[model samples]
Target: MYKLLIRPLLFLFDPEKVHHFTFSFLKITLRVPFISTIVSRLYQVKDKKLERNLFGLTFKNPVGLAAGFDKNAVLYNDLADFGFGFIEIGTVTPKAQAGNPKKRLFRLPKDKGIINRMGFNNKGVEAAIKQLKNNKKKVLIGGNIGKNTQTTPENYTSDYTTCFKALHPYVDYFVLNVSCPNVSSHAKLEDAAYLKELITEVQKINNQQNIQKPILLKIAPDLNTIQLDEIIDLVNQTKIEGVIASNTSVNREGLKTSTEKLDQIGNGGLSGQPIKEKSTQVIRYLAEKSNKSFPIIGVGGIHSAEDALEKLEAGADLVQIYTGFIYEGAGLVKQINKAILKA
Candidate 1:
């Protein structure tokens, strides 16, 4: 129904506008008493086999909604009804700011993909905390934190720490979003030396708390073996929790989308079906190169149960979905969990 009846209708309008509309639609419909119960019955999958014990928290299932989808920390509780084991919210910054100019999000239906340069355009960390205050605890939540676009280079670590300190109590785990291509000054964030310093600072603050939350790095899929080796070293050196391999791809190679059309859309990170193989390869490399030293949350181009299985088989301890959720509908979560149980 989502693919045939709802997706086609939603795809007709501007992609950004349709995103807000869907958020509102879900918010309104889920509030209609028995509607929540019925939706839960249809989508929820409960099996002891589905639980994933990773880091310190035990996930209800392996499937999660990735960060970009619920940017402000809203809708996670509502989305939990659709049987996700966890939901990651935000690439939130220290201060609120309008992101890149309009027409920044595009869809490539031919490749079952999306290109977005949304620029971490989320409400500031404080706003997210306010929304998260009402957390129902129906699902485990991961907070994805990033620097404000206009933040000075000297303050880059400060920005990540600000969001981390503020969201630590609210979210179960934390993902340092240093690899998003849409953000400004992208090069510094990915620099191995800079990343080490940044992760160390976040860890210092995390240690002060009564309970330390797991910290993970979200990396881009464009990294080669050399970079992947650096990532393994970074994980070992920092001793942070795990890695979410990966975030999105800036590589446009082998896309079925026409060159003229892609050029018109301009620069953005690609997600969904076009990135499945690339994402899995990175996962396999990290797992293999590091001898499976750290847990991995696999994401990128997962549009079906087979895709999720591929991620899991490649050594991802848990998997996340952002574009896949948009393209394959909420049923895909239940589908992946069922397939996990079957396997």
Candidate 2:
């Protein structure tokens, strides 16, 4: 029904506008009594076998809604009815800022993909805390944090640490979102030495707290074996909790989207079906190189149950979906869980 009727209608509007409209629609519709209950019954798949214990937390299922979908943490409870085991909120920063200019988001319907350069346009960590204070504890939540857009190079660490400290009490886990292509100073965030420093500092703050939250590094799929080797070493050296296998790809190779249209859309991180293989390959390489020493939350381009299984087979402890959720609708989450149980 969603793919045939709802999605087509939603697709007629601007992609970003549709996102906001959908969020508003869900927020309004889910609040009606019995609606959430019915939605839950239809979409949620619950089984002991579906539960995933990773990084000292148990996810109801291995499937999660990736960050940028619920950027402000507003729709988590409403979205939870759709059967995701967890929801990652925000590529949030210390301060609120409008992301890139207009048309920073684009859809590749033919390719089942999306391209976005939305440079962390969030309502900052404070607003997120207020929304989180309303947490019904309906689903596990991960905080994906990043540096502010105009933040100077010297204060980059400060921006992240500030958000980490502020959001620590609210989120179940932390994702140092370093690989987003929309953000500034992309190279510095990926630098092995700098990552070690950042993780160590965040770990320091975590230890100071009564209960430390798990910290995971989010990386890009575009990294080669050598860069991935650095990632393995970084994880080993820093002793951070885990890693989210990928963020989004800057690569435009083999896209079905026309070159002329892509040129008009301009540069941004590409995601969805186009990067599925690339993400799986990255997960396999990291898991292989690390000797399966740390947990991995695989994400990027998962559009079906087979895609989720491929990542799990390649050594992902869990999986996340963003573009897939947009393209396939809420049913996809339940589909992946059933497939997991069947497999």
The global C-alpha lDDT for each of the candidates, from Candidate 1 onward, is 0.94, 0.93
Q: List model 1 lDDT by residue over 46-130, tens digit each.
A: 9988999989899999999999899998799899999999999998999997899998999999999999999989889999999
**Over 4 Å off, model 2:** none
| lDDT value for model 2 | 0.93
Q: After superposition, how far is residue 238 of candidate 2 from its true place, in Å?
A: 0.9
Badly placed stretches (over 4 Å) of model 1 are none
Candidate 1 achieves a global lDDT of 0.94
State, as a TM-score between 0 and 1, how close model 2 is to the true structure: 0.99
Instruction: Give the worst 10-residue stretch by lDDT in candidate 1.
Output: 244-253
**The 10-residue segment with the lowest total lDDT in model 2:** 46-55
Task: Give the per-residue lDDT of model 2 (tens digit) for 1-343.
Answer: 9899999998999999999988898899999999999999999998998988988899999999999999998999899999999999998899899999998999999999999999899999999999999999999999999999999988999999999999999999999999998888999999998899899999999999999999999999999999999999989888898999888998999988899999999999999999999999999999998999999989988999999999999999999999999999889999999999999
